[model samples]
Target: MSGAARQSVSSALPRSVDVAKVAGVSQKTVSRVLNDEPYVSDEVRRRVLEAAEQLGYRLNSAARALASGRTRSIGVVTLGTALFGPASLLMGVERAVRDTGYALRVVNTMEGDTAGIAGAVESLLEQGVDGIVISEPIDEGEVPVRVDVPVLVIGAPAPFAAPHVVTAGVGAGVLASAATDHLLDLGHHTVHHLAGPQRWYAARDRLAGWRTALAARGRPQPPVVEGDWSAASGYSAGRDLAANPALTAVFAANDDMAIGLIRALTEAGRRVPDEVSVVGFDDVPVAAYITPPLTTVRQPFDAVAREGLEMLVHAIEHPLAQPSPAIDPPVELIVRASTSPPPGKPREPSGSTTSYQA
Candidate 1:
C-alpha cells in the first residue's frame, strides 16, 4: 500500500497495534517495548520506539494496567498549603517519578477535615494507583489498619508498619544544633529562637535541636516565640526578640520567619550580625536575594524524594518483599552575610573560651 493510503486508514490517536504493524513486529513486542520489559534486542526496541514516535502512538495506560495488574503510577498526599517545604518536596518527587518513567497523581488535604488521611487514600486507590506517598503527615490521629499497597511517609513516621523517609526536618535536632553552634562560635553570648507552630513535627524537631546544642554548651535556652511559618508571624516574633537587648543572635525555624524577624529587628534599629546575628532553616529560593542573604540550613529535598521513590518503587515491584528502612538525608548549613561576630567581640581563636555574658 502507498504511504498516503496507509496514513488515511490510520486512526488519529495511534495504538499499539498500529505501531506493531508499522514496525513489522507483533503487538506483544510493542507492549514489551512500551513497558520496558527485558529480553528485547536493542535493534528491536529502537525500531519499535521509532515506529511509535512516527505514528504518534501513545500507550494506553488503562489497558496496560488491566493486562499487567499494575497502574505504573504513584499517588502523593500533602497539606493543602503553599508552604515551601511541602511544595519543594512535591516538585522533587515529580522530577524523580518522571525520570523513572512512571506517572504521578497528587492530592492535597486540608486541616480539620473529618475525612482527612483516610479519604485521601481512598481517592488514590479508587484511581488505581500502584502505591501512595504521604508527603507530609500532620498529627491527624488516623492510622490505616492495613493498606493493601506500599506506602511511604515523609517528615512524620508512618502510623503503621509502612516505610518512611526523612527530609531536613527529621534531622532538625542536629541541624538546629549546628546553626546555634555557628552563631555561638561567632562570639554571640547566647542565641534566641523563633520557632514554628508547636503542632508541627518539623517545628518540634528544630526546637529540640536548638535546645540540645544550647544545653551541651551550658548556655541558657531562651523562651521560644511561636510563629505560623509566615513572614507576619516571624515579624511578630522578631518584635518580641528585638525588645530584649540580651538577644545577640536568633535562629528561626524556617526562612520565612527569619525574614520577618530580620525586618522587625531592622525597623527596631538593630543591625543584623553587628548587633544580632540571625539564622534560619530551609534555604528557600529567595534566601540569597534578600538583604544580607539568609544564612540557613538547606534540606536535601531532591535526595529525599529520590530515596522515597526508590523505596516505593521497590514495594510496588515486589509486594511481598520487605521494604527498606527509612533513611535521613544529610543537610547543609549555608553561611551567608546575615550572621557574624557580636559587637565588641573579636573572632574567637581555636580552643578559646566562649563567654556567656553579653
Candidate 2:
C-alpha cells in the first residue's frame, strides 16, 4: 500500500498549499489525496481530508486560473462517434485529467465536418482551459488551427505546429506490426490485411505497420481490404477474401471487423485457425468470449493518456522548460485461440520474429 507509486503527478491548487501545511504533507501529496489519486496510505488520506475540511479548501477553477495562470481545466476535441477506439481513448483522457485535479471541457466533432476541430478549439478557448487535447483526429489535408495554449495531440499527427504544441502517439503502427507478425510467426505464407479507412490516422498507422511486417519478412503483400471500421464493411471484405483459395491468415484493424470477418469466413466454409488464422487489434472485451477467441493487440489507452497529459501539464506550467522527450506507450499482444500454426503444422510458443520494423 505505502509502497505503491503515484500513477499520475499534477500540480496542487494554490489554496491547497495551506491544506498541505496543516496536514504536514507536501503539496503533491495534498493534490493526490484531494484528487482521489492512488498510492497515498489510508492514514495520510484521512489526515489530508481532515485538514482540507477544516480549512474549507474547495476546488475553484476560476480562482485557480487567477492565481496560477491556469484554469485548472482541460479542453478536448474528439470525434463524436460511439466507436470503440475513440470512445475508449476519450474515457481514458477523462480519468487522467480528473486524476490531475483538472476539470474537463469537451467538444465533439462530427466525422466529416470540415471545420470541426478548428471550430471546437475556438469554442473551448471562449470558455477557458489551461491546455487542449486533440484525440483521434482524421487526416483533413490542412487544418487551420493556431492556438497559443499548450496542445497535446494524441493518436494522430498534429494539425498545426507551434512552440507549445506537443504530439504523442498510441504507437498504432507498432501494435499493428505485432499483430501481423503473430500471424507470420504462425507459419502462414503471407498475411492479408483488413484495413480501416485511410482518412483516420490510426487506420493509416495500422496499415503501414502491416506493410512493414510483411516487407520485413520478404513475404508477398496482398491488396488491402479496406473497411469503414464497421462490422458490415468487414463482412463484405471477408466475403471478398474468402474467395481466394490461398487465403490463410488475416489481420483486422479492430475487433468488430475481426468478428464480422470470422462470421463471413464461417459461412463460406473456412474454419478459423484451421483453414485460416485471424488476428485483430484493440482486444475488445468480448474478444475473449467469442467462439475461437480472437488473438489481438491491446492498446495501452491509460498509459498513453497519462504519459501525454503529464507532458502537456509540464509544458503548460513551465512555458520555458525544455519539452520532455516522449516515450512510446507499452504495446502488448494478447494471444488466444484464433491464431495458430498453419493446418497440419505444429504450433510453436516462440514468436521469435525480429523487432518491429516501423
Candidate 3:
C-alpha cells in the first residue's frame, strides 16, 4: 500500500483483532496480555504490547470496566479557585496520577457550593472510579461525603468518615515554625503573621505554627493581620502595619501576599532586612526574583502528591494491607536577602546558618 493508503487505514480505530493479527497470537491471548491478566509469558506479552503500540490499539474504557469491574480511574475533588497553593498542588496531583497510569476525573467546587464535597464525590462515584483524592484545602465545616472506596485527602484533614480514607500533606506548622524561627534567629524581637483567609485550614495551620514558634521562644505574640491571599490584601495590611515600629518581621502565609507587603513596606521607607524583614510560604516561582528576594519555606507539592497518591493506589490495590506510615516531607527554609540581623544587631557569621539559604 502507498504511504497515503497505509496512513488512511491506520487512522481508523484499530481493534483487538488488529493487535492479534500483528502479534501473530490468538485473540484470547491478546485480550489477556492487554488486560495484564496472569498466565502470559514475558515474550508473548512484549509482542502483544508492541503490536498494540504499532496499531494504536486503544482499549475501550467501557468494555474494560465491564470485564474487570474497575474503571482504573481516580477522581479528584478540588476547589475551583486558581490560587497558587491549591492550583500547584492540584497540578502535582495531575502529574502523579498520570504517572500511575490512571485516568483523572477532577470536579471543581466553589466555597459555598450547596452540594459540597459530598456532591462532588457523588458525581465521580456515578461515573465509577477506583479511588478519589480530595485536594480541597478549605474546611467546608462538616460537609460529609459517603466515601466507600479508597480516598486520599491531601493538604487537609480527611472530612470523610470512611474507613478506607487516608490523609496526606503534613500540616504547614513545621514549615511555618521554621520561617518564624528564621526571622527570630535574625534578632527580630517577634514575628507578625499576615495570615491567609482563616477559612482555609492551611492558613490556620500556619497561623498556629507562628504562635507555636513565638511561644517556644518566650516572645510575645503579635496581633495577626488577615489577607485574602492576594497581593492587594497584603498591601492593605502592610499599609496599616507600616505605622507600627514593632513590625520588624512578618511571615506571610503565601508568596503573593509577601510580595505586596514588601512593596508597601518599601513605599513607607522601611527597607527590607534593614528596617523590616518578610518571610513567605509556598516559595512561589518568583519568590527569589522579587525586589528583596523573599525568605520563605518551600512546600513540597510534587513530593506530597506522589507520596499521597502512591498510598491511595496501594489502598485501592490492597485494601487489607497495613497502611504505609505517613512520611513528613522535609521542611526547607530558604533564607534570602530579605532576612538579616536587626539594624542595630550584628549579623551572623558568613555561612553561619545551617538552613538552605537560597
- What overall lDDT goes with each candidate model? 0.75, 0.81, 0.81
lDDT tens per residue, model 2, 112-183: 785877889877766667788988458875666556567888876667654476767778888998888888
Candidate 3 residue lDDT tens string, 42-149 = 999999999998875655444457566778899999999989888989999999999999999999998867476778887887677888898888877666455556
Deviation in angstroms for 339 in model 3?
0.9
TM-score of each: 0.74, 0.78, 0.78
lDDT agreement of model 3 with the native: 0.81
* Local accuracy of candidate 1 as per-residue lDDT tens digits, 321-356: 665665555557788888879889874332222222
Model 2's lDDT to the true fold? 0.81
| Candidate 1: clashing pairs of residues | 173-209
Each candidate's clash count: 1, 0, 0
What is the lDDT, from 0 to 100, of the residue 67 in candidate 1? Answer: 72
Q: Between the candidate structures 1 and 2, which one is better when assessed by TM-score?
A: 2
